[model samples]
Target: MLRMLPFLIVLALWIWAFIDCLTTPEEEVRHLPKVVWVIIILLFGEVLLGPIAWLVAGKQRAVRGPRQTPWAAGDTGNGGYERPRGRQLAPDDDPEFLASLKKDNKQHEDMLKQWEADLRRREEELRGKDDPDAGRRG
Candidate 1:
């Protein structure tokens, strides 16, 4: 309550330059057109010259530089802006998804060795039938 510190610092710089000129991106809105810099930060917002001319000439910011990342900086063709090439990493470091997971683990080990040779030929016909006329043929 210190005499409303310069009207709360000009209402937090007119709500941070009207939310940074409405999230600054209509192609980096420069000298004037993101709907006339949101109607000059809502009509000369209280008088700090339209949030100081939208934080000095409304937007065109960029200037960042170092952290590459478009898949290890491949696409140098900045115009079309491709950039994506390698270093993505997962799916077990993807060499064509680990060669289609080693050809589906060799077709699931040849269908588990033909279902363990049809469960050992159905356990050798239930252990060669012990004798009920050994499956009826005298």
Candidate 2:
């Protein structure tokens, strides 16, 4: 069990690093491209070097400071930066966004209906061609 402890620690660190690398946004990834970082983490994670490098440089670590938004300056009452506002609603939750999505979905449905009608017409025309007696019978 003692010998397995080291292996377990390394495995845990490797998993954490790999997950961290994958979840980190491309814009926040530092030093190397997100793809390269993923590769490095996979290739060297077992040796501890990959996880160490990733923790050190893969993602941009947020400094311990207040958040700043475009609307407000970083200044707070106590000489520290002010924290920004809370997160905004997701697109799906926004009424305007949902409306726009509905509009697009409607448009696509109309287009699909039209296409289906055209296909049916074309299929009928082919059937008419195949049966030379169709016109005569009509």
Candidate 3:
């Protein structure tokens, strides 16, 4: 087992480099094309050169800030979930969506009221024709 440690470390580094190269975006690859970097890593992985080269200079790695969770902005009164910055809100959570729904509902109600009025007018005309005395009685 002791004799295998160095080999295992190199193997692990090779595998890590291969995966990192594959997962790196094409636009983010530096100094060489992404495919070339992949091939280099695979070809010289056992010798530690390719993996080291890739890790040191093959990719343009961004210095990322601390990650923010959905609840990082506090409860927001929305089941403890807050919309991430620059992300779209769900329809149910969007004020604009609710406003549009209310506007549609008002339009529908107005249309329904107009239809009911028209129907009542038509019924009154039909009743007058059936019995000319109907309006006189009312």
Candidate 4:
């Protein structure tokens, strides 16, 4: 196991370099085209030359400070920064959606009131027809 450590380390480095080369954006790659870097890494990986070259000169790696919000990344339309990962609001939690729902509820309530008033008026008319002398008695 101890003897295999060096080989394992080399293998891991080769794999990491290959993946990094492939995943790194085309614009970020420096000194050579991204495709060339990939070919180099694959071709010279056994000797540790390609991986080392890639790590040293393949891409422009930004120095990270504390975790930054996407806005703080200072994206200047160059696709060089991360975007915000804001969570979506639920419908009930959305103020505009809730306001619309309240407006619909108010309209329905108004219609219900009108229907109730019309029903009462119809009932009164029916009673008047049933007892033509009701108003005369009063």
Q: 1-138 in candidate 1: lDDT tens per residue? A: 999999899989999989888887788888678888788778888888988887888887678989865445445565675564566668887698899989999999999999999999988788676555666674
Instruction: Estimate the TM-score for candidate 4.
Output: 0.52
Q: Which rank order by lDDT, best down to worst? A: 3, 4, 2, 1
RMSD, one per candidate, in order: 16.2, 9.2, 12.4, 14.1
Worst ten in a row by lDDT for model 1: 69-78
Off by over 4 Å in 1: 1-86, 92-95, 109-111
Which candidate has the highest lDDT of all? 3
> If scored against the real structure, what TM-score would every candidate get?
0.26, 0.49, 0.49, 0.52
lDDT of 4 by residue, 20-133 (tens): 999988889999999999999999998999999999998899988898544554564337533534886789888978999999999999999999999999999999999999
Off by over 4 Å in 3: 64-138
Largest TM-score belongs to which candidate? Answer: 4
**Candidate 4 — which residues are off by over 4 angstroms?**
65-97, 100-138
Model 2, residue 53: distance off in Å is 0.2
Please provide, for model 2 over 1-138, each residue's C-alpha lDDT reduced to its tens digit, 9 standing for 90 to 100.
999999999999999999999998899999889999989999998999999999997889988888655445545634464553587678877797899999999999999999999999999999999999998998
| Whole-model lDDT values for every prediction | 0.82, 0.88, 0.90, 0.89
- Total backbone collisions, model 4: 0
For residues 73-137, what per-residue lDDT tens digits would candidate 3 score against the true structure? 44564575544568788999999889999999999999999999999999988989999888789
Clashing residue pairs in candidate 2, if any? Answer: none
